[model samples]
Target: MTEEEKKTADTGQQEEAKKPETSAEGTKEQKEEKASADTKPETEKKADGKEEAAAADASAKDDKKASFFKKNDKKEKELQDKIDALNDQLRRQMAEFDNYRKRTDREKEQMFSNGEANVIEKILPVVDNFERGFDTVQDEDKDDAFVKGMQKIYSQLQKELTDLGVKPIDCVGKPFDPSFHNAVQQVEDDTKESGTVAVELQKGYMYHDKVIRHSMVAVVS
Candidate 1:
């Protein structure tokens, strides 16, 4: 109603509106800090979960690599075993072939020796007849052309027999061995020892190292 009283009331209203409220501002700041604190724990838990998943994946990869290496080692061992078995089989086959070759060679040698001995045995009688015929020739006829031709032929026959590994056995004036000499008669001889060959009735022949024919002889008693 009075002018001064009205003026004072209007100034009080203006000051009250301009002044800040400390209690309301402090309460709003506290609520914002609590929201930030609550969000930090969730972010950290997500990071931890991602790290655990990465470690598990790495372990699985390592196990797979180890399995691959183990399989390769098993395959190598199997291949080596097969190679060793093949080598052993080849060695056994080579040894068997060598043994067979040696056996065949021995058989061939034995057959050849038997056949040569048989042929030489049949030819011995003809050689004895040739010697007997030569002994009957007279010394007066020795210079004749026919006798000379026969002597040359006999010499050629002896040379051929010598070339073929045939040789006459010594009987007269040598010891009488039953293997090489046949004693047809026993006689006394002062010039020779007892059981010695005094006379050779028929000559013996040897083919190589074998006696093809035995000498017919008279032994000193």
Candidate 2:
């Protein structure tokens, strides 16, 4: 063929070879870009998962701490309530014991007073007999040894009775009281007022504030 035609054909063949190489390079670059894009998405997903795990762990720890505090607070409240109840019970017991002690002391005092009154009441007749015996003694026997001894013993008995809180109730020339004197006889007297005690027939005795024996008296009206 001609020289110019041969040169043109050679140039056309070189251009065609260059076009295939260019197309292959473009495909390889596209594949590498797509791979890079995929790796970026995976890395982002891993980072998100790690963050989520860290958040969950922190939440669990906070919940555990809150529950522990709540339990401790409840226990403390229960202990305080128990202590208060025990204190109340102790106070009640102490008050009950004090009341029992006071009651016992009062009962003992009442028993002692009653016993003394009963003994004094029984001995009243003996005391009356002693006074009558003293009245029966003659003037000549007043200086006798036996009479003097009897008089001293009677005086000593009276002094002992006075020391024991025993005293005679006054009935003569006093206003008649049913609580202190019993009227066995009534008399009309112009000198004394009505409902007045003129004479005492039997002696009445008092032990402290209580009457052991009532006075038998004659009332003048």
Candidate 3:
């Protein structure tokens, strides 16, 4: 070969070696940049995961607080309802007791009145017998022992009746009142006033200030 052709061939060989080295360096730089970009994306994903976990924990704590408060409020309402029921029951019991007391008092009063009436009714027959014995005795025998005995019995009966809150109505020589006296006969007399009682045929008795029997009387006009 010629000398110039040989020199050109040697230079071309050196350039070929330099070109391979530059190509290898450029490939290594590109690989390093791509690896750096991939690592940055992984770091950002880790930060987002941590934030999501924190938010979930906070939500769980809030739910627990709400549940506790709801349970407490329900218990408080149940307790209040029980208290109100107890108060209503107490009031009803008190009212029942008061009504029972009033009824008992009324029954006691009625029993007392009935007892007094029974005693008075039993003694009325004895009073009637004494009156019949006194009426049978003649007025001319007023000083006789039998007549005096009847008077004594009548006086004793009068005293007994007075002690028992009983009294005789005075109808003779008084104005005739239908409330206290029953007129059996009417007579015209100049010596007496009109509508006045001339004589009492039967004595009237009062028990506890109330009239038990009206006096039988003769009225003069």
Candidate 4:
């Protein structure tokens, strides 16, 4: 063979030996890129799971807070209702007590007035009898035993009437009052004023500071 042909054959053998080493390096680089891709997907999945758990926990806390507020509101409303009822009851009781006190006071006043009227009524007839006895007894016989006895009886009747809150109204020489004096006779008298009481014919009686009977009087002009 010629020397140039021998050189070309040796170069072809060297290129064949380097082909296996290049193929092995390319395979190792492909394996590393595949492993990196797989690890990125796993990391993303873990981050998504953590975010979902946080959201669930927040929702649970909000629900618990709402429940607590509702319970507290219900309790407050119940307490307020009870307080209002108690206040209303107390006001009603106070009004009842005031009414009772007023009624009792009125009753007491009426009882006292009634008692005075009753006592005066019983002694009125005795007073009338005394006046009749005085009219029958003469001034000349005033010193006599019968006259003295009648005077003593009249004085005792007066004392009894006074103790019972009975009083006599003076009509002689006083102005005529329709409330306390009843005109029984009319006379013309130049010495006395018109519509004035000149003389009292019958005694008037007052019971418990109130007029029970008016005096029978004679009016003059």
Question: Best TM-score goes to which candidate?
Answer: 2
- Candidate 3: deviation at residue 213, Å? 2.2
**Per-model CA lDDT versus the true structure:** 0.87, 0.93, 0.86, 0.87
Candidates ranked, most accurate by TM-score first: 2, 1, 4, 3
Backbone clashes in model 3, listed as residue pairs: none
For model 4, give the 10-residue run with minimal summed lDDT.
116-125
Report the number of the highest-lDDT candidate: 2
Least lDDT summed over 10 consecutive residues: which range in candidate 1? 15-24
Residues 25-140, candidate 2: write the lDDT tens digits.
Answer: 99999999999998999999999999999999999999999999999999999999999999999999999999999999999999998998898788888889988998899998
Q: Per-residue lDDT for 1-221 in model 1, tens only?
A: 89998999999977776555555677778888888789888899889988899988999999999999899999989999999999999999999999999998999987897788787778777777777877898989878898888778878878988988889998898898999999999999898899999999988888888887899999999
Question: Candidate 2: lDDT over CA atoms?
Answer: 0.93
Residue-level lDDT tens digits of model 3 in 1-221: 99999999999999999998999999899899999999999999999999899999999999999999999999999999999999999999999999999999999977886677567757776787888877787779878987888789878977887887888888888999999999999988889999999988877777776777789899997
Worst 10 residues of 2 by lDDT: 116-125
By lDDT, the candidates rank as 2, 4, 1, 3
| Model 3, C-alpha of 127: deviation from truth (Å) | 2.1
The TM-scores of all predictions, comma-separated, are 0.69, 0.70, 0.48, 0.62
